[model samples]
Target: MYFTIRPARPADVHGILTADIAAGRTSPADAERFAAGISAAVADPARLVVVAEAHDDANAEGGTGVVGWAKTHHWDYADGPAPAGHYLGGVTVRPEFRRKGLAAQLTEARLHWMWERVEFAWYVVNAHNEASLALHRRWGFREVARGARFHTVAFDGGEGVLLSAARPQA
Candidate 1:
């Protein structure tokens, strides 16, 4: 449960992919595309990709590696409510690392980052993903809209809900 959150680096791409696969959010066949996306996010100033690395003393190198990751994208609101703002997506934690609060930590970090850059931000969760929906609500995100037919890299024609939160008062 002891982990550090930081801006993602290119070196963390593999670990991110590993976690995604371990969590059943992605497949090995998508590694190439996922790597490309990670690389692009690392280089894009408008995007925020962060990784949580836990201490791994067993490794011969005696270092930490990525166990979870979350990223935000500049969304134009072409499909959901709100004009244009940052959209939180691609949040995943390794199966073994679940229930340790790492997801909340990563989300808070991204929210803080978005707060300084945008007046509002959005998050999307599958309608069936109760835990995520509850977590977002706990972070002050309110449901703005729900789509009966939603499609994404990980899901197709599924129920999705859009949630929005404003920048916290100073």
Candidate 2:
């Protein structure tokens, strides 16, 4: 699909919510809460939220709409194996758009943003998510530790793998 990645705007919140709903993450009734959360992130200087907009071949410069989104969250841990830094957040895309490398592209964009401010990028994933683990490995992420919980987040699968990738010099 022809698309471009860019920082999300307030108007993109609805499209992002649509994606989340399509992924079965939430219901349409929760749009207000979702929009508020996204709005806060967009307004925060310490956090980064980006979207991938699909474009028609004939109108590549003007997007058709937001097809996917990814974000990062800053976590300050007073005491934990997970250090205080910006952590990789989740990526969501329309179901029809899965397995097309859109996730990788979104991840690369987040890493690029992270690398500009930190020496290492951190991510915590469920141990059972082999696909995500495999995808991240291609970006140089390696296991730092494994636990039932990291910082304040707990894995639904009961075990989470904490991984980090050093910033590659540009």
RMSD to the true structure for each prediction, in A, is: 2.6, 1.5
User: lDDT at 151 for candidate 2?
Assistant: 77
Q: Clashes in candidate 2: how many?
A: 0
Q: Each model's TM-score?
A: 0.87, 0.93
Counted clashes in each candidate structure:
0, 0
- lDDT tens string, model 1, 1-170? 37888998888888888888889988899889988988899889999999988875575353457889999887554653434668887679988888999999999999999999888878777788988888888768988877763224233667778778988788
lDDT of each: 0.81, 0.87
- Local error of candidate 1 at residue 13 (angstroms): 1.1
lDDT of 2 by residue, 62-142 (tens): 776788899998987623788889889888988877877889999999999999999999999999989999999988999
> What TM-score would candidate 1 get against the native?
0.87
